[model samples]
Target chain A: MIGTLVQTPLYQWHVDHGARMVEFAGYSMPIVYTSIVAEHTATRTAATFFDISHMGRLRFDGPDAARFVDHLVTRRTADMPAGRVRYALVTNEEGGVLDDVLVYHLRDGAHASYRLLVVNASNHDKIARWVDVHRRRFDGQVEVSDLTNSWSMLAVQGPNAAELLASLVDCDLASLHYYTAAETRIAGKGGVISRTGYTGEDGFELIVGANAVVDVAKSLMEAGKNLGIVPAGLGCRDTLRLEAGMPLYGHELAEEINPLQAGLEFAVALDKPEFIGRDALVAASERTDVPVRVGVELSGRRIPREGAEVFLPAGASPIGGVTSGTFSPTLQRPIAMAYIDRSHAEVGTELTIDVRGRHEPASVVALPFYRRPSGRESTS
Target chain B: MKPEDLLYATTHEWVHVAADESGGKVATVGISAFAVESLTDLVFIELPEVGRQVKAGESFGEIESVKAVSDVYSPVDGEVIEVNEVLRDDLERLSQDPYEAGWVAKIRMSDEAALAELMDHTAYQKQCADEAH
Candidate 1:
């Protein structure tokens, strides 16, 4: 029998707003509020709110906090300025990704320095144990604590998200650069607001106390109601991120999949002197036969779902399988991300996807099937 | 559309049987409104050819949503007579009017015995409620 699922602080609020609930990562989360396409379009054009409290929040402090964080993830955290957030991967000893996390370096805390790591909810327990095991090897003073239950995260995303949220928060949303965070107040509640998002749009992620999350969410929704703000769910979240070509933890990165093959070379700091999974990633990078992740756009309306085989033109053997697939609301077409033979991972490479026994025509395209007009500038 | 006039398959497909001008029994088939809502975001559909033969309980077509793909099982053994080709271009019809304009296909029944085994509207409603729990 399945264990009881957890509910976020906004669970009742979502139900009252006509959200369709679904079980995801041990949490009873909303999959859609009204319609997936409507919510997805709202996030792209106006503003949308997502209850992301299911994510794990870990806080580290002490003199050795910076050093310990650098050793844990693939990104170079030692030089990360305060109020900055970096997307990084935590890999196992064998170089496989444990989880993709956002490492935020807070400006001030009770300790000498503090670093917060926001991780995937499903991998929370596994990552907590992983951090504990690695902390034993560190020589300096460091303390780690799991703050997942104490905090709730909400993602306010879209082109107008920053402006809409600025009215509700006490921070200077205009001055806040993308990927930078600030300790601020939302609806009179203390929280951390970061100008970061996964929807390939300019947005902010607000992390507030569990008790104050509902009030903050309600306040933001009320303020943005006139601006076409909709409460989004896990369904549109997947499609938005997929349209942006972001790799999900289980879909693109897994216990057996490393960051190198997933086209996340920038996150891995190869120049670092020592780190977990460094050697394994170095070895895997030199291999020619490694399957690389690539985006595929079907020539027709049929979606190439996860685990669907990808085959070379007229070739009998399967080269790879789709990891994540969706009908992009922005593009209004079916797109997918797949791990195909590196030789066939180039843009415009013709291929076929075995969609329910039928080989549908497809072609390899560049990552991120959709990009906003002002999205050319890199946030991270 | 009233569910009382239609027969339902356990797979959630609805069948409307009527006599043509020549007195031959023809079955019009489509998925129920409940199934359409459950699937959500209809994106693509594949229907059987006009001349193809289908068996009761056998998959005759496919429907795809953003996150899932499902097969539309034939409710009674029959030879495909006509297909709702317009649905391939306008999938929203499947959810907007699943009972009338969204009917997937019409078939000339080869085996009438299968129709008796299908459920009525009330029985189907009870089955849906039981599955909800």
Candidate 2:
């Protein structure tokens, strides 16, 4: 069912800058501006920014907001202090992931608690309705609102991201810790800046008013020109996240794939007092037969795409399938995320992928095929 | 060779027919410049082997970009005589020089009747323009 696609505030800017537009999640989004490899490299080496305005941003307020949110997600959000953000999962009754989101506890200086949820663009409508349907239990004590159309989000990532953003914002961004956000003024407009990103590098995500986003983007570009910052697109974003071993909603996560199977056990707070998927997750935790997610490195350059079957050299039946795969720009080879039998999920176990008609040699490697050098004081 | 001198298939592959020293009709095939540009950032190309028989409009190879995979169809029916091994390592050449250095395979046509099914350069340009819109 294809509906009319909406455009972001930066659509014209993307077009004027030579972006190749593609329809993504009912929006006309840029798949690339210059090139995927170039944009990916810039984010890994220098600095780059992405227009992440399409992601859903939901806000909940009122005295019972924290409890209502904690009931909806797997993480225990009621205890999150102001200015804190946590990665959490929204799951169905069967413990399958509905969406993986970032829960932000904002410090808005209001008497009632304020919580913000950033969800995947593809699952925006679904999660919004899920939150609405469950809000009835709160008996109007908690208020739910959708801020997706009114706000714009951007991510500036790489090793030099902090240094580049420091010149544009009024606050000392270098002081912001990872997974923490602060209210700051950019181009004379108030916004929220968080030191979090999907890339396996240091970065910050900026959320500003939709009307003021174009100005903010221009200012960031002008300030970052000398630092070699490029405008990246969703194509590189997928590669960047895959290299970081992040679970994409539709790939590693789905209605039938729980967080536990996706290797996101840390995000699921099973110890929480009560939640929608608590019972199923509690049962899943004790089970040892579920296929687990693992990283795979192919010996050849041919990429193994999603749905490609995984097998052993001597086995007649497939063990599992690939969830995501790409020719990693950083690793300079083919890498993938696969869900396979837990017994074969070891770091060095040999496997094979049926890439189209050819069976390519692959090995069960560690997740996060690429990791930035440590000892950098300010990266996540 | 200039694109105007070549013929094209509806699938966006360009065909350049020339007589070899042995007086056999050899067709050098590569994806059109328009196709290469649209399939941005080609990461890998699986070329057909030298001695493979391929039918017209049949998928003879695959070209992979960062986001998608597309089949590279044969524009003429023939036996593949040569494949550009250079593309196996440096896929950028396929996008940079799609009409010349990026040629994927060379085929010795067993029958020339398939040439009638192709479009001339002018007609091919119109087809691309319509699809882009």
Candidate 3:
């Protein structure tokens, strides 16, 4: 018999609200609250909350904390200012991505600076073990701890997210620039709020104590009930991220896929003097035959699902394969991301996706099939 | 509405037997409500042409949701006589009234004995409940 899946602090809330639960990353999570399209549109127009507690959170504390983090990730985190966050990838020595993570550089104490890392849930154990084995290369001053179980994470995202959250959070939301974090209290509970999101909207991610998160979520929902805030689920989360041109770990980044090929060159700082996967990424960057990820817009209504073969116009052989795809609720068309030969990764390149057995015509388009318009200035 | 007079397929399609203008029996086919609910957020569908022949247990059309795709199978061997082309654009009908207005196709039965393989309303309801667990 299979083992019981872990439940988030908001598990009962989701079920009470008529969410359809599914197993994801060893946890029972909500897949959809209502219709996927409805929830997706609500997030784009107003605000939506997602229970992201299943993601792993790690804390590093010590005199060499900054140095240890700089060695672990691909980005230059040692120089990152306090209260700032950067998206980075943890790669193996061979330049293959193990997981894409968000590194948060919080305030420094007298003896040590603190850094927090948020990683994918499915790779939580693997990443924890990877860090344990690699921290041996650093000085004994650094200490690493897994805080995944102690923290409950929730992301409130959309155009009206700031206004909705400002009513409940004690800190000033206006000063929190994009990709910045601050310690604050919400609904009388201590927490960390960051101006970051995956939905391509101006939003905030609130990390609170696992025991106190339910009250925070309830307060935010009550405050935003009139502002069209709805509780979103994993289904719309997948669609929203896809529309933003974000790459998921399992779908776009894998052990055999390097950062350059995944179009994540921005996250990799090759100028860093020393780091894991730097050499392999440098060599891979000079090579021209690597398959590059590109976005495709179908000429018809047929959705090109993951693992669908992409072929050249009138050609019988496969040229690439789709990584993630969905019927875009915002664009009202079928959009997908695929890894095709570098020669065929140009904008407007004509291609056909073998959706099941039928070949459907499509064209290479720019990444991010949709971008939300920036909202009004924060009300402080 | 659930139709007690219609025969149901194990694949969750309902069939209504009727007489054509020439007094020959024709089977009107549509997917059941359970099938529509399971395939949430219907996006697109491809139906068989009016003159195409279909065999029992063979796929005659396809439907897709945002995350999944499913085949609509024929319950009895016959030639397609008519199709509800309107469902191509208005997919909500599939879930709103799956038995009547959402009927996918009308086929002129080639073998009337094939209806013996289908289940009744009560039997199909029990099967759905059993599969739920």
Candidate 4:
């Protein structure tokens, strides 16, 4: 019998490369290699590669596919231009988050109408089953295939990421705007490259077919060696994203939280006719007492990790708990994201985070804590 | 690493025993270099307040790394006399020189007999080896 756990193609490579292994998202992923700070700095200054094959990828096709998926998601799939990508949260019927996914519309004059939905690895089977169960509701024309087992993914991130990738691929990387994606070849193998990332860095997420992923990743690593490209693990990935105030699944988004409360209001298309969670989200927006997702910078070096209590402004009782925290290399301090009372979510509001036992002071701050302007300006 | 003249704990704690100016036995305890290497990049430390009572084999405080949190157990039953407060800001001292600047706490042993129960240098090293395998 097969083990319940799965390892990516580069599992042995990670062990060989001195990765500190840990289980995350159901895969034995590298949480760190040597030091998280080193890998984080590499991504910000130059480039770093990641094994994100654990994340699930499913393909949808057929004539009425676009229209069918439009009903399935809050975003209007029919409106998505070919060779583009958009971030959307898949919600359950009760308005709870099913998963936050990036949809790739690959209708670049191809005869087939196909869209690739990339989802969190932990919720792969759950999302696949959910989509299958709801397939008939999508106007009975769209066919869904769980390509999760047949695909591997990599994300090369850094300010210099585009330069390295563009040098390797003949495609004009400068034309690609943030949130846009395209189907291209790397070393003569085809894959989808998207200009989106978990870390707030300029990067490309290359989705390779199962067979080609390993070779593509190896080539990218070799090509980026002089660029200080390190093989980053999930530990640095978490710290880097948290520094940029990105919400992680299960930490910031969960089955109990809707997009509105999680501060993902822009992703929810309220103007769209009807979708899952529309009614509940409408009612949810009316509630003034709903909690909000906010960022906090710890005063001291002591980091307030997940489950640590977050005391609100002054002597008031703790209104929330830390969802994720770490010593960010860029910010050079302990940064965290937590869900707290809307009253206490205002930027610059002082609070205390009880890190283990001591009350470490913190302050609420605006999100996307680090932003690097794209070399290519958005024409939109 | 700080060399504790007293017997050591198999959990990697070095205990130094000395007769106080009074008749009571005083034990200064801290983690060994091997333990510090096992836990890299210390982020924060929670040490027991001075004058707090602790039993032998009981946790006096904890040190947190990016990876895990490990409790520092008292080697002998006693009252906390002093704590390494300076190490709070500079936790690398534990990995740098666990024996001296990394001393976790000093305690006045309530029962001097507790020292007899701990392992000596050679035995503690063997225990550390056995546990790892």
Considering the two chains of model 2, state its CAPRI-style docking category. medium
Candidate 1 residue lDDT tens string, A128-165: 99999999988998999898999999999987787688
State the C-alpha RMSD over the true interface residues for candidate 2, after superposing those residues. Answer: 2.3
* Residue-wise C-alpha lDDT for candidate 2, range A330-362, written one tens digit per residue: 888899999999999999999989999889999
Off by over 4 Å in 2: A1-3, A109-112, A377-380
Which regions in candidate 1 have their CA more than 4 angstroms from the true location?
Answer: A1-3, A109-112, A375-380
TM-score of 2: 0.97
Write one digit per residue (lDDT tens) for candidate 1, span B25-132. 999999999899988878889999999999999999999888788999999998999999999889888899999889999999987999998999999999988875
- The DockQ-based CAPRI class assigned to model 1 is medium
lDDT of 3 by residue, A1-380 (tens): 11388999999999998887888999999889888888899888899999999999999988888898889899999998888899999998999999999999886334235999999999999999999998986666789999899989999998888989887888898889889997778878888899998887778999999999899889989988988999999999999999999999999989899999999999999989878899998889899898999999996888999999999999889999999999999898899999999999999999999998999999999987887664543212
Worst 10-residue lDDT window for candidate 4 chain A reads A371-380
TM-score per candidate: 0.97, 0.97, 0.95, 0.89
Please provide, for model 4 over A117-145, each residue's C-alpha lDDT reduced to its tens digit, 9 standing for 90 to 100: 99999889898888888785655678888
DockQ top scorer: 1
Clashes of 3: 0
TM-score of 1: 0.97
Clashes of each: 0, 0, 0, 2
Cα lDDT for residue B65, candidate 1: 84
In model 3 chain A, the worst 10-residue window by lDDT is A371-380
How is the predicted docking of candidate 3 categorized under the CAPRI scheme? medium
lDDT tens digits by residue: candidate 2, B1-133 = 9999999999999999999999999999999999998888788898998999999999999998877789999988899999999999888888889998899999999889999999999999999989875
